[model samples]
Structure formats: C-alpha cells, structure tokens
Target: MDDAGIYTRESEYLDCYVQLGLASDRVLAVSFPEESDDEDADHALLDRIDAYLEGEREEFDDVAVALTVPTDQREVLETTREVPYGEQVSVERLTRMTPGLDASSDEDHDAVRTALAANPAPLVIPDHRVRDGPSGAPPEIEQRLRALEGL
Candidate 1:
C-alpha cells in the first residue's frame, strides 16, 4: 500500500498477500486470489482483516485502493466497493448501479463481467458481494467469504 493506496494482483496461493514498499514503509501491492506471508508488516489494515476473519463485521470502506484499469472498468470496481457487507447484488443490479451502463444490453453485461474479472483487489473491493458473474476471486474463496458474512 503506497501513500495513495493499496494496489493488488490476483494470485492462486492464499486468501490475501501484500508487497511492501521499502522506502515508504507502505504496502505496494496486495494479491487476493492466493495467500502470501506478510508477517513483519504490522498495520491496522491487517488487524481489520484478522477481525473480519474472526466473524466481526468489517466494511473495509476506509481502505484505499489504487486501480490501474481503464476508466470504465475502474468505475465498475469503484461501485462494487460500496456493496454493503453481508448483502449480495446480482451482476445485473451491479451493472445498473454503475453509471453509463444499460443492464438490458448484453454488451453492458459483458463489460460488467470483464470489469469484475479484471478487478485487482477482491476482498477489499468486496467483489464477492457481487454475484452472477466473475468476482475476481476463486469460487471456493468466494463461497467462504460469503459464508463468513453469513449470506
């Protein structure tokens, strides 16, 4: 996580992992598809994550993320970030919520799906809360996250 925010890459090892910026002492990147060790980096965000895993409700809205996708895709991820914890919204609904998207259009639906798949941060963006399309997370991971939210 840099001064601006955390940047993430999808992985296939653990639930989450982060790369630290040596000079800034901030996280440079976070990976959601898999797990990695960040045992030495003590941050409040990590604490919050721990809390989330233990069944405490954590909105994660306060966390900042740096998106490197195109404007259209970025908008989709930004909207996805606002999805409330414990609630799920279908891709159609999510597409509708995003500005300039026409849910009735198949192309729009595809855009939403593409945006979701391109999401760099899954848990932080709460992609799991969006259903009926790719969540930028593994299927099992998505199920686990939803179950944790009691959804």
Candidate 2:
C-alpha cells in the first residue's frame, strides 16, 4: 500500500491471469506476472483481512484504497464499500443508492455488474455484499466471504 492507498490486490480466491497492473497506481497495463512476492505487503491490512476472515466482524472503511476506474463505476464501488458487515444488498438496491441511476433499468443493472466486475479492491470494497450478480471474486470465494459475515 502506498501513501495514496491500496491500488491492486491478488489472492488465491482470484483466478489465474486475474488483472495485474505493472504500475504503482492507475493500472497502466494488465498482465499476468511470472511471480508474486508477498515480502513487501502491508502487514496492517493483511492483519485486518485475516481478522475479518476469522469472523471478528472487522470493517474496512478506515482503510484507504485507490480506484482507477471511471467515474460511474467508482460511484457504484464506493456505495458497495458502505455495506455493513453481515448485510447484503441487491444490485437494484445499490443502483437506487446512487444518484441518477434507475434501479429498474436493465442498462443500469448492467452498469452495476460492469462496475463490480472491474472492482480493484474486492474484499475491501465488499462486492459480495452486492447480491444478484458477480462480486468480482469467484463464486466459491463469494460464498466463503458471505459465510464469514454469517449470511
């Protein structure tokens, strides 16, 4: 994590060839690197992630993250990040939460899906909490995250 915030993350839950950025921020390019080094990881964030996974009811709003996506997707992800632990909200509900979005429109739903699919920080944003669609994480990982939250 830089002084700005977390810009990218890789996890076992994320599939092979998952989006990886070569730059420090803004994801200048996407590629599958030959190796992953965890030596320089932010221990504090790792500890929070571990604690949350351990059913400690951790909330990540305090942690800073850098989202390099477009404005619309950024809004959707920001709203998703506010979903409280142990609670799930539908994509429709998420669309409704954002201004200028019509929840009933399929286009809006697709936008929500697209935004979630491009999520830069999955667990911290808690995309799994936005139900009825992909959470950017794999299905099994989403299930595990939900179960951790006692859903």
Candidate 3:
C-alpha cells in the first residue's frame, strides 16, 4: 500500500466484496463492500480464499484480520471464526456454542445478531456459516460462501 492507513480497503476482487489494508502483510482491516474503497488486492491473502473456494479445507488461518468489535461480541465472533469450513450453524446454535452465552436471553441474542450484521470480514471470518438465522453479510457474498461450503 502507498500509505498504511491511507490505503483504502477497496480492492479488485469480483464485486469488490473484500477491502483490506496490509503493511508488510500485516492486515489493518478486511471490510465489507460498504466499508471499503478501491485498494490493491493482496494476492497472497486472496489466494487463500480462492484456495478454500476451490475445495481446500483451510481458510484464512494464516491471514491476520484486524477488527474493532466490541468486547461483548468478541466471544461470538471468535466462535464463528472457528466454524468448520463446510459446515453451517444457526445463530441460536452459535450463541449456545459460545461459552456462557445465553441464547434464550433477548439481549444476548440481539448482541450476537448485531455483531454478525456488522461483520467487516465476511469470508475470512465466514459469517456466512450462520444459517437458519439472519446473516448480516451481503446476499451475494453469503450465497457464494455457502456454495463454497457445498451447502
């Protein structure tokens, strides 16, 4: 990137669904379409996504993503990131899977949904792995991610 923070998250991947900033391969952010602007694609980072889409099991394990989510939702996001590459889980299930999460509590449930809706990194974090519940990711992105997972 020409400048660290100056580099926009927008990049030239199909539909520009991914926007990321890397200085010496350390990720600054991987944002959504609305959250990104045109920036150079980190080919190596993109390659891992492509590899996963092409049926490779691993997904973005080596790529670091910088996020600014609230502490209240950190457990949810971290748990979502651990979802198996080709598996799907409902938001309810995610909440239950997360330690000390109470899916039955409306406040906790909303917190989980809100965190997912604002997920900046879709494929990398695989928010689309969420099924039978609201997915905050773009429809196209969610569809594509599901397709890759063979769902």
Highest-scoring model, lDDT:
1
lDDT per prediction? 0.72, 0.68, 0.68
Candidate 1 lDDT by residue in tens digits, 1-151: 5344343322222345533222243233345424443343455666666677678899878776667789999899989988999999999999999999999989998999999988766778888888677877667777888888877
Residue pairs that clash (backbone atoms under 3 angstroms), model 1: 1-27, 1-28, 13-34, 13-35, 14-34, 14-35
| Descending-TM-score candidate ranking | 1, 3, 2
The sequence of per-residue lDDT tens digits that candidate 3 reaches over residues 1-151 is 4334424333333355455556655565555565543554556565665566557787665566666677766677778888887888888888888887898887777878887887766777778888865565668767766886786
For 1-151, candidate 2 gives per-residue lDDT tens digits of 5333322334443333223332343323232232455333454455566566656887678765567789999899888988899899998999998777899999999999999988876777788887686776666777878877877
Backbone collisions counted per model: 6, 0, 3
How good is model 1 by TM-score? 0.79
State the weakest 10-residue window (summed lDDT) of model 2. Answer: 25-34
**Residue 109's C-alpha lDDT in candidate 3?**
77
